[model samples]
Target: MSIKSATPYFLLNGRTEQAIALYQRALGAKTESLQRFGDVDGSCPTAMRNRVMHAMLRVGNAVLMMSDGPEDVKLPEGGNVSVALDFETPAALRQSVEALAATGKVLERVFEAPWGALFGVVQDEFGIQWMVTSPLK
Candidate 1:
């Protein structure tokens, strides 16, 4: 298969581990690999070394990556963009939303929209926005 330039890469703060876990619970994420900052065998500072330097979780067809922020760097406020999920079934859609709501804020409930698809929006506990939907045939 050929690659495309359309995929997104999110830059999260110091909660890489927690974010990964949340996605796992809500999206059936399977962590492909996680390299801690301490795992960086280079000459990086001790404080910076043990932090998450790089980690990847494969959530279905998407790959989400994360890492720690600089020592004192704070996460930014709400911005553009949200994760989009296409569910395979209505049951999956409902279950996923309920699970996500456990640790996140539900902006909207999953329901049939005027656009002819069931959709909803949420913000995970880690402050990441998500939009789940399933198209009707």
Candidate 2:
């Protein structure tokens, strides 16, 4: 069997909406579809009914899937996973870095890397790490 596509799925606790807004602003992400827990046939808990059950976003050529995970689960502050974004132009990369940094912590400022590329790292408010980079000109 051949794999069709691989997408990054984020379990945002109860902040999926906030993350969605941030991605829209920082990465020009568009929500292709979203389903709320309330959409289910009255099986969801009252508190979680308003939360997002699933959302599909299109960022550039990639698709990002996310959800407000079950209430019992708690995500740690930082994890081993990081989302790496590669841009075609330095300007685009810089723009995304600034936007993400506005509401997030900049672990590394954008700079020329030894590998001949511009790179930086930021941890968003939701604790999701991002590595932003662009190829050398």
Candidate 3:
């Protein structure tokens, strides 16, 4: 068996662009690729022509894949899966948390744990949950 790379993929109904912009601003993520439904030939509804058909974002070395499609059934609170971002500095960690928390909720504000690490959880505006962490210097 051969596995070259693994990435987290998100399916957000009518919100992929918003989520992509949030990550790009908060995590220093770069847009690797984007293909809108409009790019497809008659595959999507004209109402959803501007919707995201596919997108790839690079945060550090991690690649995030996503698309805006049909709305999903509401979970208890979105879902159980969480995307975590580990950082090497306090500034980086803080910046990310603040960015993701914009128009969102901070489940756990950044704080020092007994293990001498900073940790927190935030659900982005799109209801996607995330864990942010950093080691104390």
Give the best candidate by lDDT: 2
lDDT of 3 by residue, 1-137 (tens): 99997787888877788888888898888999999878885766678778788999999978899888654443243467898888999889998888888879999988997778999999988778888889987
Best by TM-score: 2
Cα-based lDDT for every prediction:
0.77, 0.89, 0.83
- Candidate 3 minimal-lDDT segment of 10 residues: 69-78
Per-model TM-score, in order, reads 0.85, 0.92, 0.86
List the candidates ranked by lDDT, beginning with the highest.
2, 3, 1
Error of 2 at 16 (Å): 0.5
lDDT of 1 by residue, 1-137 (tens): 87773454555777777777777877898989888766766777777777787887887788777777665787673358787888887778877888878977899977789999999998877667889998764
Q: List the residue pairs that clash in candidate 1.
A: 37-49, 37-51, 38-49, 38-50
Pairs of residues clashing in candidate 2: none
- What's the alpha carbon RMSD for model 3? 2.4
RMSD vs true structure, all candidates: 2.5, 1.4, 2.4
What tens-digit string does per-residue lDDT give for candidate 2 at 82-103?
8889999999998888888898
How far does residue 117 in candidate 2 sit from its true spot (Å)?
1.4
Model 2: residues with Cα > 4 Å off, grouped in runs: none
Q: Which stretches of candidate 1 lie over 4 Å from their true place?
A: 1-5
